[model samples]
Target chain A: MSTATNKKTVQLSHGGGGKEMNRLIKDIFFNAFDNPILRNEEDAAKLHFNGNTAFTTDSFTVAPLFFAGGDIGKLAIAGTVNDLAMMGAEPQYLSSSFIIEEGFAIDDLKTIVNSMATELKRSGARIVCGDTKVVPKGCADGIFINTSGVGRILNDHISVKNLQQDDVIIVSRDVGRHGAAILMAREGLALESELTSDCATLWPIVEQLIATNVDIHAMRDATRGGISAVLNEWASASNVGIEVNESAIPVCNEVSGLCELYGFEPFDLANEGTFILAVPKTAAEATLQVMKTFCHCEQAAIIGHVNDRKVGKVILNTPWGSSRYLDVPQGELLPRIC
Target chain B: MSTATNKKTVQLSHGGGGKEMNRLIKDIFFNAFDNPILRNEEDAAKLHFNGNTAFTTDSFTVAPLFFAGGDIGKLAIAGTVNDLAMMGAEPQYLSSSFIIEEGFAIDDLKTIVNSMATELKRSGARIVCGDTKVVPKGCADGIFINTSGVGRILNDHISVKNLQQDDVIIVSRDVGRHGAAILMAREGLALESELTSDCATLWPIVEQLIATNVDIHAMRDATRGGISAVLNEWASASNVGIEVNESAIPVCNEVSGLCELYGFEPFDLANEGTFILAVPKTAAEATLQVMKTFCHCEQAAIIGHVNDRKVGKVILNTPWGSSRYLDVPQGELLPRIC
Candidate 1:
């Protein structure tokens, strides 16, 4: 659980462009999506592409400008890079726009910009264009970021449409790491064992996939609405049903216990560091092997398989030996947990 | 001067997704950016392009989850299409991502979405992909929008760097209409003479430009930071100085009077319905003649002339027979004035 220090209504410390911000970034966002580009603590992620084009964008507005793990600077870069990777694109150029509240600290602004420059270096993306605006204090929550990315698409053959009926579903790692980490930080929930966020870039994993001839079909980062939302979207888009053995779905023991205590479903919680992949039966083994070379993918597994569109829904075979339909969440179960 | 009614704080009427919203949108955003697609008021903007590809996105977040200016729906579509026009790209496709506040009005959301459908038709763009998220209420200010646009690069000769000294600056008329209108609606700054926003699509203007064989250097829409920011950026980017004759710059009389009362500088004020064109001295006459055929360009004028790099700065020749250097605004003068 998060400590009391984590739960104070969002303060400037969260966006202060200081140590607190770094802690927040590492503890929450970085932990959720761990990967090489992010772990390098660089400005931007560098990626190489063979063909096609990749495009993505991310908007970030954390209550405080600075935080424990990172500030809006790192968040903006990492978020967009991850989005491109989710589409199997080699992240490249980026455009950033800032909406700042009136009377924001100029020093803080400079810090954020410098941090952004640093992260951009790491990410290997150039800031080609940018925009800035100021909103009345009451009209905005300090500073908000909107970043768009354009990358070279690696392979046109890899796409969501390629998913076969019996393709297996694989998650990069444990669930609820991102959501729970944020909750703990936001609510200051105390826990015997500390838990941090799982935010990190997945460019390395994507690179690995591109280098290998794995029969990967669909790929999506499990964020915002979490694993449930992603799976639902994939199922709907691919016109297939999914059947998962709950016990096979990887979940950190600590996260599972925390979710049980909070009455939150691990599957419903958001995870910034995780991604979902659909692979053909024959390619699943090789794909999982490639993924395991990355630290965050060690526990990855094929927890489910695609079904015919006639089955058109998600079902979970629970640990209790009971089967239940998992419907697309109608609304957000954990708001602002991103 | 604005009336007392125009000074009241914004309420649900500003984003209600109804007649009030329509009024607010027309009176502010649309009024500032008047163009063919916007005037049509269709479901999407139809476009014709001859290039590799185009990109666009629209993100909407209206506080209270709704607004008088067609809610998050209309704004999202219009905003994205407009962005494409600024680049002289025919908006071909768009992507939307929604960050909804938890417990928002469901019916309101549907209205916004429906509005987007209509606006997209009017603009002649397609909604190719989308994303939705519900954040806890306090984490967001009702709703925020982020839109991306994609269009073919059009003519290979079009580039900002093409701007040369002696180029004439042409502005789409009625400066500050959108910014001032939004301010009035948002702040309830009522005036005896009602002012409307200039938020419309400029694809037609862009199409017209393509039809004209006149030499063009660069183009930019006066949004966000407005004409002052745009001019300064264009001057710096093109490595040329710009001299604007104050009397020649177009300004709606009502907006001028309001700025006088509010101590805002018309040049520094934001404008959505306006665009700046930099054309070679030789092609200036023909370009202006062609532009005059459009209603939106009625008040268009040759406001300034680009000069050599030695004078690579913006200068204003005042009505008082004096000249003053107009520096790029170091900070935002009007918060959320856009």
Candidate 2:
């Protein structure tokens, strides 16, 4: 019977569901993600959920594990919570499962799990149930996490097809920061400015949006293919044309510089904490006012509008007064950029 | 863009959230797990739930991907749904996330996903949302799958702490087949007799037991640590003693042979589809009758009973009438046996 405190690294026994596995779970996971529901230690969590619930799942396989602003644990929690928040839901319960290599560092695992617990507080979400699996040394990378969330729907009107003609399109914050931060880390670049990933939990800001009763037609977080994917999906799903003023899109100087050097388009670069919304022209000003209250969202701007002029397409109007179709991203830009 | 037929192996572009990614999702996953909710094409799935629910998660990193009788996909689905079943819940919805290596075979992915769909039908569980991520070659062995499930609770009294002094302990089927089969695969053992994993969904049998109104105090699948772990947990949690008759426990000849050759204890080996149940002595016959009607559970047997003779421990009664304590399995006997 070896204590987890004496172990510096994880072994296959840590996942064997034996005495050692229980010790690690208690000394680490239980201590970090402690809650009434999680403390029950049942095979499955018993939860009380009623009416409509938004359910979403995401897996985090970010390279380097630790990034500029956040690590994989923070990303795992924020990613799923944001997915639920995008549906106008109150992030509630989450299940965190880990796939760790045989020789992963115990300290690193604890640090990652601690980050997850801290991030969960942003939305008051609970990690109710979990599973841990360990593979041989070379079977997997250092670690991978999967989180699935279930949230109560506070506003059920949000839908991809709910966009109306003449609706205003809003971007929550500056784009391309997350993609650029990861690229910089992978290339071992030490630039003058300190760039960081925009990865964060958006439920706090979203709760305010819902509480204020903003008539949000649709909402989505710009993740893998960035703002371009979200707008293109909306245009096709709603059978409406989206016109974006390229000059109005907010891109930080750091992100733009990285994009320029990497030959990447800012619109197609991913952002973890950023989101897009569709609102009636009448509600656009109030929406921006509520959004600006959050420091991280102070730069929120109206970059586009929806109409039937070019149905089922996204047209980007450059600052020089020339417009062109903004096609969805093709091929792979960077793998494991999440 | 290239057709999926022409792409023999998955490329990084297949996970880029663009034309190739969309094509891959549609041509492979959507075609296999096709349903209205999954085809809705939203960031999250909208589900309606009332009252108490059971939520659980598991990540499958089983070796060889395909084993004797089941693959990782089938194990992923059954493992999660069985957790819900153990909680006396009606399996309803699931969210699946896949982390695939860059050069994995598309055909193999199709086969695995198709197996998942087939397993889901046994429990009437739907895969409502999914995520796909591709890492560069050598980052992952082949593929890993995570499944999270939400099910409505039908019989809420089934809990590990609900065991009573006079309860009857039951084994749903033969034990240790799953662990033995995996060992056989890994060791390249070619015995004259056939051996396969006892991996299957147990929701049907559980539903029958619920409908029959058998007084099930607690139920758990004999998974990672096999029957030994479950009994020890029940005894410790319920503050009761469990006495098992070694002669009463069922073990297939092939499994016993493997155990003899490998010097492994059958009670400590894992069993995916087998389960343990505790019921009042009065309901023991009725429980066995209900369980025996299922073809897979033809060997259901009453292997033990709960008592206060030795609290917080499990005692094994030998055929010679002597008894000894059955402690929890200690170290990693096998990794990735799930």
Candidate 3:
């Protein structure tokens, strides 16, 4: 029979579906994501969609909650939004659900909610509907957020199986920053260098590519298993072999150092905002030009090209002019990277 | 660098975005919720939507996982589907995400997924997209599920703020079954009589009502906080008063016994499948007739009416000829009852 009034931390009563729960939702979630659709206060949000739409979902359980570049809040929003953007969709409406542990600080929740609001602004997407569940202490970690997004598809040609022969593979920027940054934070390594996660909304850049009509064949963000995973999936799905020059792939000094020290492959490390693109050879220069215009993607480069010689495989050519198969990562590299 | 080859329980590698993870998704998830959209294998599922759509999201963290009538899997599907049905929408697409703890039994995970697939068949809603994440042992309770759904809005007139004066309020069936069932399971009450949760998909019944052309004003499932919370919300949002006949509200014997022993009110308990509807007095008989035709809602009855006597409040008329304000339930009734 405990009341949650004037409490510093969340209580079980805050999720009891009663007066206290209503007040908490209005105070935190509604206050931060204020909009007309949300204010309607209906059981669900009513929206208009008149064409091909893209729907995606992701649950963020990144440990440490906070990191060098962004917190779980920003990652939750950006992750789902990027899934839609990678399909050449205009990120529009998102639904967020939170499972918070009891006794979690109100201040921390507010900070996370505010971060979500800030990230939503980058893509003009609105948090139209949501649910909150509070579990007893020790039942769960601090909190986990699941975001599901539905957006209007700007181009229907973007897909993993759409890669064309002789298509150029482009890495948006330096790989492995996000995975390396998280590793450093977990290892308690306070490096003197500036190494932050490449965690930002990619809609702005994707929109520019779409507006420029750069015929994107295949596009995917290297999230969990990084570029190696994406290349393998694309190779199998499109039945094309990928040839990449290892020396041409961009890797920051910090990430390379972390990988060297930890015996991890840079290509297999996750990236929050970095994405790989497969475009026709004729559109490669135009795509690179558009991507480089963005500050975060200034180092975007052509890393490889699609070929049929080694079908259903990814071939990496090292600086020594010897090539080897870059198979799909078979075991766990890192946990909770996203 | 351990692998999950033929493992009986889940490992961290199953969510590591590698070979093991892909195999698990394909063998279990893709096999159960199979459909063309899901088989497309894109970052986002491409859907075609014309006109208005309804979107909603929910996360299920029910303790014990299994319950008297429905498990968390079925609850997760029906809960989100019911939200869309409450808005006079046809549930169409759903995205499911699972957060599993390391070492959770593969057999149990399969059963939950099977339950979700079974429930989705009730509303003809397809799970078009999903995400899965696994944490280290003890980071989460056995498992948690989050489902987000989008559907086409059939009737835009139904809203929380659309209640008109003299609108008759009809409850679908007896109240408090869901909350009582969960409580009983948690407390280990071996009641002999049948006392199962009313956790079924309500779209079929709602569709019948919509097809009958009933002029529905406000409709909401009495999930958490039961009918009391729903009525209070309607009154405040529509700026009207609701007068409910206390005795007219139906309550099962099991629920009554539990409430009497626990010093609780049945009005404040939760019901998963039970719902309340507000329609003009002329449409009241039709609504009840439609509801009564369903076996689960055979006890459908008119319990209240909307009026301007007391703005933004609910009044309960007792059998003793005395009336009192029915304030929204306060404090915690039960946590994780969903």
* lDDT pick, better of 1 and 3: 3
- Candidates' lDDT values, in order? 0.63, 0.93, 0.93
Query: What is the TM-score (0 to 1) of chain A in model 1?
Result: 0.79
Q: Which of candidates 1 and 3 is the stronger one according to TM-score?
A: 3
* Candidate 2 docking quality: incorrect, acceptable, medium or high: high
Model 1 chain A poorest 10 in a row by lDDT: A40-49
lDDT score, residue A189, model 3? 79
Q: How far is B12's C-alpha from truth in model 3 (Å)? A: 1.0
Instruction: Give every candidate's TM-score on chain A.
Output: 0.79, 0.97, 0.97
lDDT of 1 by residue, A46-108 (tens): 233334555555667644445444566776777777777766666766656565554565556
Give residue B285's error in model 3 in angstroms: 1.0
Chain B structural similarity (TM-score) per candidate? 0.78, 0.97, 0.97
Candidate 2 lDDT tens digits, A1-338: 25664488888999998888888888999999999899888899999987999899999999879989999999999999999999999999999999998889999999999999999999999999999998888888899999999999999999898999999999999998888888888998735569899999999999999999999999999999999999999999899999999999999999999888989999998889999999999999999999999978999999999999999899999999999999899999889987
Candidate 3 lDDT over B2-96, as tens digits, reads 34633888888999999999999999999999999999989999999999999999999997788888999999999999999999999999999
lDDT at position A7, candidate 1: 50
